[model samples]
Target: MQGRKVAAVVAAVGALAFVVLAVLLVPWDPVPGGPLHPPPASSVFTTDQIDRAEDFAGLQRIWSWSSLAVSLAVACVLGFSRLGAAFVDRVRGPWWWRAVVAVLALTLAGRVATLPFAVLLRRRVLAYGLSHQEWGAYAVDLAKGVAVEVVGTSIGIVVLVGVARRWPRAWPAVAGVLVAGLVMLGSFVYPLLVEPLFNDFESLPDGPLRTQVLALADEEGVHVDDVLVTDASRRTTTLNAYVSGYGSSRRVVVYDNLLDGGSSVDDREVLSVVAHELGHARHDDVLIGSLLGAAGALMGVGLLGLVLGRRGSGPADPRTVPRVLALVALASLLASPVQNGISRQIETRADVDALEATGDPEAFVELQRDLALTSLADPTPYAWSHFWFGSHPTTLQRIALARRFEE
Candidate 1:
């Protein structure tokens, strides 16, 4: 028994070291900076923009708090109460099927419980002119999202339970590999399979803009075949763009709103956006993110195994489902800060790359201003909130970084 405990401790320590080493080894190219300077409020945003941004920021804060409360309440019910176990006990099926049923039931119930908050948030977005999606369309999208979650979560639960039952002692290592593979598979297929369900994508037409985008990719040594324009205008009026997938599956997607001539977005802003995404492709940020996710999964599963061993419960035990779910939820919540910190670093690197690739820091600044105004992003967000939830640097930071190019 002492031997097993010592082994587990050693394994945990080794896993921690591996994760830290992986992060440290990532090639983070430096961006030029002297002192951290906040951009002037007057120059970064107008009076009207600031007022609208503050209103949106307040609404987001309320939503964030309410959402957190609801999530915690749900987690408590699953972890502390017998409701999850009861459902699993009463369900008539094989162990794997039972796990699936339990996962789906909990997921659906959680979604229902949070529906009001989701609806309220959607209404707030509409009021802020951020989202243009109609109620019916929104409902459709919500259903689609729920369906995807059910499928993915059920598969994961079933796999975990199966592995636990098959290899009670070694399940953690196996499950970790499975989770890592799934993460990579999801990243690879998302551009081709998952994304199209949400928005229609079409190749950018032959034009000076397309020409410029291809040239930017070439300059960055990124072999991007085509830039795809997504029909995001149907759902959102906000300007945005992203890069997804890797290798053959990789592509740059620009929002139609950004491409619309009637919109305030200009060619320079669009070029900057494309260049930023190209930077992600050039650096293979998606692959790096997946690798990190793999490491996290390994550590998480190993930890879960140790906890389950302590409880004298195998993963296949239906009663353990609730505990496992609870642990996973808690772990995810706790890890948010670390995950977001890494994301912000990657995003900041892409921003720097964009500035370098375009050699147009002025355009980058304008693009940042346009994004903040159009998205109603708060120039100054609460430090705690930003630390926990911000995936990218604050808009002011981005603007300040762009201004550094001028110096």
Candidate 2:
């Protein structure tokens, strides 16, 4: 009977998801194949591209809003009723009580910590240009978003940790402080904490590849750095290499997959990969990205405030505020595709930089081609999906750009 009940609940949830998807995808009006918005003759894609982009945007908006509604409804059903009761009952009595108290305390701590910092950040952004002000406003909204994320996540961690300590038979905490802390504190400290969890990182292994990497950096007038390899294959089959850290910590980290054979990419190809990554670092793309994000956040908050304040409750109305915030967050998430498009542009620029820095456009091209094949990345994804989820330009686009840079 208990097993049947669980299965029924799972089926119901799956049904809800299917319904939401169907509603979003079924368009009210048919989209035309012709030019929706004609652009200059020299643009990358043609009239069909514009038309498809429009169609996808329409669908994306529908999906975004409807998905939020569906998700919130599910959360409410889960949180306030029998599902929640079942969850609460699973915990051992005194420990359960203690865990609940800890969660509440953590939530309150996050709320208290966030508000003033958010406000100050908002005010600082407003002091800048109109774009800056807009971005700053968005930052304030993001600050609240972070608070919500932090508190909720912290509570989950505390509960899990508490449960592990009390009842080892239920679920082991498995990894030690390094993994736990990294998993909990994701954004800023991810590189510092989570990275060390799986792999060992000593200085760049003495090799020809290290020499070549440093030489390329030197030629580009960029500084020399360590080339560290991490055992990333322990967690994933994905082959990746990146340059991380701001100053002294800045180093190239190649996953074990890159060196070994999840993909057949050689050490030479890895060098080219790191060159592109270094291009991003040298260009200060990360810092620029953070600033852009902060600006967008500030703008979003101010806009959200202006719109919601006029029609609905003030920011203090805790009851309606969360709902309004939820809507605002949904809107922000929907806008992510547009941001991703910008990021792809930057990535292309970095590729060009990589070619110039390395003076090896052919090697870069080879590396990119291999990467595309290895990652099983679509050669041509739907423009809208690419805009939303993809940070790098399409494989074709990157190759073409690399050729142009070489020329």
Candidate 3:
């Protein structure tokens, strides 16, 4: 029996690794690249546009499907009966509702905790100024982001368990919608309402900085309704700026820290940053990320159906449903590094776009180094770690690319 157990563990590990490798390596080059590629021409971004892109869409699809399948298999293969009993005990509700609540509460808690940090970072940039804050506020923001993710994920487990018990028949569908909602809120609503909570934002002071920012936008043919500067100094010191919103929601935000950090960044430098932010806004990265999440969830459900259907048994105990969901959620978390890698690649493209818009390689390099140091980002990171876990490429990488463009 002991030997058999060991074998099972090995098998499980092997299967999980296989799925991960498949996902990471599969060719999924959906986005196209080129200087001439018209903006808003396509929803999918291309690699030629990105600094370092992977053609792994096929792998992404396979990994996604296999991951869900394996997650379900693991729950049962490891000890489905045990997990089911635990689920029922923890969430005594009709079963399905309990799981739903568990998932929502767990997930929401994570979001809520990190929200304060994003708020603080913005506040510091606006009030104290980014150049002087020493990254104290930004640190908190980063911490909060982690806290939200951890706590929110915990709550989600409980909610999933409750859901299975309360509404076994429709639990999957309901869970999908809820998960989708969280993704939307986190990606969209939080950047607007939640972001301002920790910072003070107002229209840019009537000055050359404001005028130049707008003029550059016009030169690039990027339309903007307004430019706003936040008082990030009130909280801590870290200079930064980003473009937020989508289509109608679009706007450019600059932190007060950005202004005080430099004597002059030139119109072209500001334009570079603005252009980078615009890349995100124009590509609707927020919406696309959410949609990807929704797609992942749906795929998870389909995989679950395939497994459960094969066994000829619907969850015998509604409580087990949560455990099943938990399995998938866990798998997703494990795959986060891959997702981060994809995001980093996309960000690199945005950087390139920013450079192209301004034609100021020197400014872009300066901005990159300044931002890196301001954020205390390590200039050189382990290649594997960066590829798997880091969301943004290392400072050195960015500087190198900037120099490449400068020449």
**Candidate 1 minimal-lDDT segment of 10 residues:** 1-10
Whole-model Cα lDDT per candidate? 0.81, 0.52, 0.55
lDDT of 1 by residue, 1-407 (tens): 44235336534754785578556745444566554587767777778888889988897789867986787678668865887888789999789888877777777777888888888888889998988889999999989888888787777778888987887666666776787678778889888888888999899999899889898888789998889999998898889999999879999999988989888878988899988898889889898887777777767776777777776745768767777777878888888988888888788889888988888988898898888888888898889989998899888888888888878
Task: Name the top TM-score candidate.
Answer: 1
RMSD (CA, Å), candidate 3 to true, equals: 12.1
lDDT of 2 at 91: 50
Tens digit of per-residue lDDT, candidate 3, span 1-407: 33223323433443454355435533234223322221221122233422111222223334444544554454444234564446446765655455554444434443444445445444434442334443576567656655555455544444444453465555455544565555555556655765665666788778786777677677667677788778875554545677655556566787776666453455556666777876665566655555555555544543453444344333435444444555565667676785786677667777776777777878887776556545444344446756665776665566666666655
Candidates by TM-score, descending order: 1, 3, 2
Could you tell me how far off, in angstroms, the CA of residue 148 lies in candidate 1 after the best superposition?
1.2
TM-score of each: 0.95, 0.55, 0.60
Model 1 error, position 269 (Å): 1.0
Better of 2 and 3 by TM-score: 3
Q: Report the CA-based lDDT of candidate 3 relative to the real structure.
A: 0.55
